[model samples]
Target: MVNRHRGETALMVSGETLPMRLTLGALAELEHAFAVDSLPALGERFVEGRLSARDIIRIIAAGLRGAGRAIRDEDVAELSFDGGLNGVIKAAIALLEATFGEDDASRPPQPPA
Candidate 1:
């Protein structure tokens, strides 16, 4: 009974493990989708000062489709490490911000009389 208890404890300590390869695949797909679709929109929003950091992250995750199951907060946290999905998302956001200065606000606003 002691050995069984120890085994169970070990399993519990290990926690839920995500497969490394699967995670990598998901990250790659997310990166690709962001590059193709969401990045431009995010950039536009940033230029307009309408995109927050959290909003950028959420948009990137939402842009990922048919990659796998929905990415959870835990996955986002895990991906924030070096060479991870979070890094990719941040990079994309930075690129957009740099490329498009906050000039959208200069445009004439729509009248709502």
Candidate 2:
């Protein structure tokens, strides 16, 4: 069960739906992982959209931990996703949106006049 208002997302992995959140501790861990000094800086890094495959793994792993799961990046890599790579990426994106809320950049571009 996910509570979007509380910044919660769900991950479909190994035939199960796992709840994920970016709790303060989890966000701090991400900050350290990215070598960023502040939460905003971490957010900025994501905004840059220059993430590697490893970065995706780390983000999802942290989200799992945030939801109180004893999961690791390596463990996450081993799990099979419901919708494959696309699903995995969606889960990470959802976690980020839950934490930071969606912005204009995430929305579809409007047609030019």
Candidate 3:
């Protein structure tokens, strides 16, 4: 299960439900993987929704690695997806959104000093 409010998502990889989140290091890795010159550029690229199999694998691998999981691109490529391609796509989107989605706006205002 994914807790959107907490930026925690569970992905089925290698027949296991692995927790994933993106750290600053993971985001930087993604920028480098996509050959983007800036973080905004990376975000824009994903917004365009154009990616190859290798790209998906890399992105998911980064998320796994960020969560302290020892996974590689090759391992990611071999993982079985019960939900097929759609599941992979969903997991990728969930991972990205969980990491970079809008800030929570429902919290109560801070008390005055």
**Estimated TM-score per prediction?**
0.29, 0.87, 0.81
lDDT of 2 by residue, 1-113 (tens): 98876788999988899999999999999999999999889999998888788999999999999899999899988989999999998898888877886655578988999
| TM-score for predicted model 1 compared with the true structure | 0.29
The lDDT, on a scale of 0 to 1, for candidate 1 is 0.38
Candidate 3 matches the true fold with a TM-score of 0.81
Tens digit of per-residue lDDT, candidate 1, span 4-113:
11111000012332211112343344446445345455345445656455554543443232123366534453443344555445544533333343444566886899
Distance from true position, residue 73, model 3, in Å? 0.6
Evaluated against the true structure, the overall lDDT of model 2 is 0.89
- Name the TM-score of candidate 2: 0.87
Which is the leading candidate under TM-score? 2
RMSD in Å for all candidates: 17.3, 3.7, 6.7
